[model samples]
Target: MKEGAKLIHTSRIPVRWGDMDAYGHVNNTVYFRYFEQARCEWIEQMGFPVSPREAAGPVIINASCTFFVPVNYPATLVIRMHAGEPGRSSVMTWYELFVEGQDKLYAEGAAKIVWMDNATGRSVPLPEAIRALFDAAAG
Candidate 1:
């Protein structure tokens, strides 16, 4: 997490057997899924629809992840999400993944999400309610 980033949401997701690859470790792709789940949970908790086809909704324009340690099965992942300053139409969300009861970080990542008009496929300003939540979190 960055210096000014605000903790927004935390999610506990169990590592599934299918999340592993032939290398016996959680696949790199699965890290993004974990990040997505946490972000979605945060959005849902904010009273926004996850995927609103007829209304403006959040959409990720960019995403990336960094693996610090290999994660194995039979562990519950604690993903904590943090929010940077909100822009007119987007916010940068950061994530940290760790095993439950463990202090070591397994992975970290971020995604830049922009509010978009579903019908027009163009960016729109962040909803006032959402922006207010970000403001409060930053405090």
Candidate 2:
């Protein structure tokens, strides 16, 4: 990941009551869910159809998140995602979550996904079409 990366998608996720922890703040794990949704939407928007039947698609191999601020109920989170330059069989996706309409960052995350053959459960090179999609999005 680099500084000033080009973001492919931004999504707003409403903070739900169930997302809060016993401490009255958003639980740490809930932030990853927001990142997941943003990543899925970005891939869809890039013209790649995602389904179990698809011969090849991205699968998360590594993922991590960092939280900086606590979010309470009655607020929305804006998650921004970026597609990194593709590797031979994997791509890195970066995420940043901010309080809606605020500059404060709530969380940051990154994921590395390997294109896999669903039937064989083996890693495979990203399809040319999908590679092009990521390239265009990164540009």
lDDT of 1 by residue, 30-137 (tens): 999999999999998989988776489999999999999999998999999999899999999999999999999999999999999999999999999988997776
Best by lDDT: 1
lDDT of 2 by residue, 25-57 (tens): 999888878888888887787676778888878
The CA lDDT of each predicted structure is 0.93, 0.84
Residue 15 in model 2: lDDT: 93
Scored by TM-score, the top model is 1
TM-scores for the candidates = 0.96, 0.89
The global Cα lDDT (0 to 1) of model 2 is: 0.84
What TM value does model 2 have? 0.89
lDDT of 2 at 51: 85
